[model samples]
Target chain A: MLFSLDPRISRLELPESAPAPPDKAALDQFPTYEVFHQRKENTAYVYVGPVHAPEADVAFLFGKEQFSRRFPCTGMWVVPTEAIRVTEYGDDQQSVYDRLPLLPADVLAATDAAVTEAYDIFHLKKRGKAHTHVGQVQATSPEAALQAAKAAFGDQRPVVNVWVIRSTDLLRSDEADRDMWTTTPDKKYREAIAYKVQDRIDRFKQEG
Target chain B: MYGSASTHDIPTQATTGLENEDPILLAEFEARIARGEKIEPTDWMPQLYRKQLTRMIEQHAHSEIIGSLPEGTWITRAPGFRRKMAQMAKVQDEVGHAQLLYSAAETLGKTREQMLSDLINGKSKYSNVFNYPTPTWADSNVISWLIDAGAIVNQMANAKGSYGPYCRALDRICAEEAFHLKYGHDAVVHMATGTPIQRKMMQEALNRWWPAIMTFFGPSDKMSTHTEILMRWKVKMATNDACRQQFLDMYVPKILEIGLTLPDANLRKNEDGVWEFSEPDWEDFKRVINGDGPCNAERIAVRRAAEENGAWVRRAMQQPKAQYVRPLA
Candidate 1:
């Protein structure tokens, strides 16, 4: 029974073995797709749900297509799985997490303003080391970084938990693409959010 | 799990929990509910709270999914282009409602696929309303007006129900239900003034659905049932009778105003200013939930087909595409 995955269903017990993550052997063979969603305006990007694809471009296209097909969706981001420096359960390799806060010291000398930038989302909230401030300042200067983070985040919503990378590190949509980013209207009648059942109720009642 | 933080916490305590556990913790749990603190997910609760919620949420989810069928039938048959588009949009909203419901059930640790499979396999429960057939477009109006109205009132009561996520979902859902109600009312009004044939269809739809509509509120708050534990756990804010009565009181007059006779000969408004009605065949209610209703087989089959047919889509979404090979290789 669907509901009975109910611990009561009494499954055939298998012998206990050491718990381990799935073999990474299959990882290299699979195409990777990262998911990004836009819940509201000036809201940073969020991980609503995921879908997988092979190449970077294809992954974005698939993620955008599959996840936002149902309702009112504002934006989507799709990145190749490999393009992200994600950590797996059993890897010994240094992850994007391992590289936090340490831009090579001489590299700090290389950039005049990025280091001194007053707490961008990346500097304060460790999670969003990926994207930010829509297309604005890109957290370049300390004041600019703070302003960009503040500007992108309205009402202090943890709506988008992640933001990072030099604006140069990512590929994103431009203003002209806003019309394209809208949920392609397959059929607006199927758009539930657009209809108000109560209004009709009131109108009928008044007419009666 | 122990007691709740409501007046009903003790009363709604489950038989399963009562059968187990230390007497002292059970006592203390009861005491906690008597104080009226909001129950959080991490807080201790009876296994019954989880079970009842799962039952309610899964059944509710199933209802939304199956609820799509009645509207779905009319999506193609709707008389005009506007009605066609409206029904289509309404059916799609039901799908979204199902998503929200399934997610609520998941918070209790269940999965969507598991619930869908159970619904297909005959082990889960959905509302009794969907079991009866929708024989006409007028049935569509009655459903939106009366049927959806029943659901909206019930859902509105849940806005303050105990489970946080489910309650929150109900709040959002109730806000959207206005449009659904309006859609139904619009259909009813149109049918009321429509050709003789249309009026006859609407009246017939009401007659066919009247009893099933009453039963949809579920069994009365009877002895040996578990309303006590439900109320205590805050799983149900209003009693079954309370909800059903709310439906009749609010809708009976509306039904009459539309120039239709309710099939219930015994149904009438008492001088005390309450509508009195004949009791529904509880046996029929039992038979349906036990999987014996009119369309039980068909509903299950349709769900099974969706689960089976959508397999490739689920797989494709979960899997990566084939990797490209070097030309030399």
Candidate 2:
């Protein structure tokens, strides 16, 4: 095994300032990808991995490095940065009024129907979570899609809002890639038995 | 990965598409998290989930980035070859860990560069522990021992967290922490039984770190934290006080056995099989987390310098390939 660093602290930045940018801003734009993990068919999709690639395919390598390094998983999904439909939030209206409750119930109901142009996406969460996308799907129209999500999901619990996106637009990793999931300790350094070298150091101390 | 926040306007939930009383949609989403399940990216979820997840993940992402300063300092000053090596590996793991976490956070819909900018500008915050300085070389051992110990305890429980990626990262981090704990303990034991100077170093380091270590878990969230909403939703797996207590129960004895006295005079084990210590100044915890700690400014400055310095590396990666530059074309 090799010598290990203390796991207590992190090192993305340095002491005086940051060490430097880890990758190119634009390079990241093209090469870095956002990872999505599906724990099970029943569970709502969540962001669970990271992959890097200059193109969509390259994302698989980095995504494997990021998501499957050591953690066990049922499935992994990696998509290019451009493939995502992201809307920025917290604008002037937030400061203008009504911070909490998100929206008036009536507004919630009306917008739900009004925005039904087609292909709406919904991100749902019971509690707020990191890697939250709530489950997203494309439908013919936003309202109908929202309706479908509600029928498929439910509206009793707090289902936030629906974001409409065309399914065809979303870039998803091949769900059938069994090979990526099976290649184990061979490729990942951390998974190697040698990674336990520090534990050996601990055992050495305990022996003394 | 930075966002175009300047042009982005916040839209109410209505605009995002919650048109009618979709009772069915709500149920499925609730059923998912309620069954000890993780919500995935393609499932039907409400918009608020994405918004809230974005906020929390961004802060956590920033934490991983800002968290580096205190310990990275000691990488150069670690005692012997073993310590130095251990320190190096640990820091690298942290970088990897941050990458995992930021990637997870981005799923909530913000880019990594955007999160970094927030950290540099002081708009985002990390764990209060990072806001303080590691004043001595021994401080590195203490950080690995205590701070990491506290984090492990929190993350262990968090491995069961509702969100998939955060939980996965926690699982991976927890796996690595076993070695980390041993490294810190090894340091403590090595120092305690080593030279007289080494023992003194350990004590001083503990004295400075003990309170902050206790504060590692945010102050008792009894009065706030919306734990009910969060827990039912799966944002956190346990309560702050409970996790803090668990950390004390597990580590206090270990620290003492390592031949180090905790800084508290009143620190003692209780009749109920719990180790009890004086409450850390909750106010101080707030102050530290709020960016008023001893080393908060210094930590931020270091992060900014590193980010700025590293800009070209990022630029180089993005520069058009020289292979494509034809002669006089």
Q: Where in model 2 is the C-alpha error above 4 Å?
A: A1-31, A34-48, A52-208, B1-24, B46-48, B223-225, B319-329
Candidate 2 structure quality by residue, lDDT tens digits, B154-178: 6677667666656666666667667
Q: Indicate the DockQ of the complex predicted as candidate 2.
A: 0.06
Candidate 2, A74-100: lDDT as tens digits: 565555444444332222112111222
What level of docking quality does candidate 2 show? incorrect
Q: Candidate 1: which stretches are off by over 4 Å?
A: A1-176, A180-208, B1-14, B18-43, B223-225, B320-329
Residues B128-219 of candidate 1: C-alpha lDDT, one tens digit per residue:
77777777788877877787888887787776666655764565466557667777776786787566888888888888988888876766
Q: Candidate 2 overall Cα lDDT vs. reference?
A: 0.58
TM-score of 2: 0.63
